[model samples]
Target: MIKNLVHHKDNIVTISETMNCLDAIEILEQHSLRNAPVVDATNTLYRGNIYRYHIYKYKFHHPDADLAQVKVTQFLKNTTRVVHENDSFYQLIFAIRDLPFIAVLDKENVFTGVIQHDVMINYLAQAWVADKSGYVLAIQTRGEKGELNKLARLVNRKADIQSAVTFEKTTYDTSTYLMVTLPEYLDVSSVRALVNDLTRRKYDVNVVTL
Candidate 1:
């Protein structure tokens, strides 16, 4: 399913290993990129990433260094962060947390494509059906069993449940936030009724219009 997040090979911007820092900086600036993946001489093997700031910082620290002599490989990084096509979404999430994107390679280490954070945001937006009109009920619970079923039962009686996503557990109180969405056909009264029901059941609930 994570393949849906991948930007295919032809869509990736790459800098050749032989390319100088001066040229790489220009290309990165033109694309409004902070960094770009680097490839081997044949442009098949993925070397790593080259950052625009790193090139400028290097020049500032070493003013005498010739820009033409500075190859992109000199500042290559995140070589080990690349993922295989079959890698999982959870793995990609951790691998790309600190990176703008993660380069994806084939079994032979051939550069295939990349998965960027922006694409991940889009995927999450699609999952939330953000473009469609709906109301989100942000509910907090203590992870008690039967709570979700009760909430679902109550919501379904009044409105169609568009989607439900559980956010990460809160460290402070060890509670979970469940975002339940209602279809556009429902009104504020429907949401208010559900909120009152959940509140009476000791479930912390709030409604947000989307």
Candidate 2:
């Protein structure tokens, strides 16, 4: 998961606070981005996020205003929407849901870059491993030790595993659920056998998607 979120240095985009609003707007349009991270004059310190719509509105309200002389530093917002480079993957998801992206900072709080919304969504889609050619099983279990190992051992002997993801079904509950994808080679008879085996072991198994 960290590999999906972090190590994205090649895809990050940013702007400098010293840049004029017109220049920033042009860059945003060129890249087709909604928002961008603003950095200090030296481009090392993170300032805040600048939105394309805000710049467009400013231009509309002040048509004769000198856009070249107007710095982006004066109109930046959500300066606190930032996460450290070492932050957990969950933190990145929580921070960027309501925004376009979150600024990434180093140990010294220096501006690095941003994890864009589209990039995160793409990573999550890959993680889910969506497919029409496979069976996805949702198994509900208590937070028990060795349960995963037992399930893996049982399932591996029967069918090829494609992808798996475990998540807490609810924040207030201690119950957890595991979603496993079986290869497309698995047929109805094999799926029924797998389900029966899990039921025999006193585990709740259900077919979620196929």
Taking the tens digit of each residue's C-alpha lDDT, what string does model 2 give over 1-210?
Answer: 343455343455678877998899899899998888887768788889899888889889999988888999878998988888888888888887888777788888877677777778877766666653478888887778998887888888888777887878677865687878887777888988998998898888879545
What overall lDDT, based on C-alpha atoms, would model 2 receive against the true structure?
0.79
* TM-score of model 2 (CA atoms): 0.73
Off by over 4 Å in 1: 172-174
- The stretch of ten residues in a row with the least summed lDDT in candidate 2 is 1-10
Q: Quick one: best TM-score, which candidate?
A: 1
Worst 10 residues of 1 by lDDT: 166-175
* Candidate 2 clashes between residue pairs 3 or more apart in a chain or in different chains: none
lDDT of 1 at 155: 72
Best by lDDT: 1
The lDDT for every candidate, in the order shown, is 0.84, 0.79
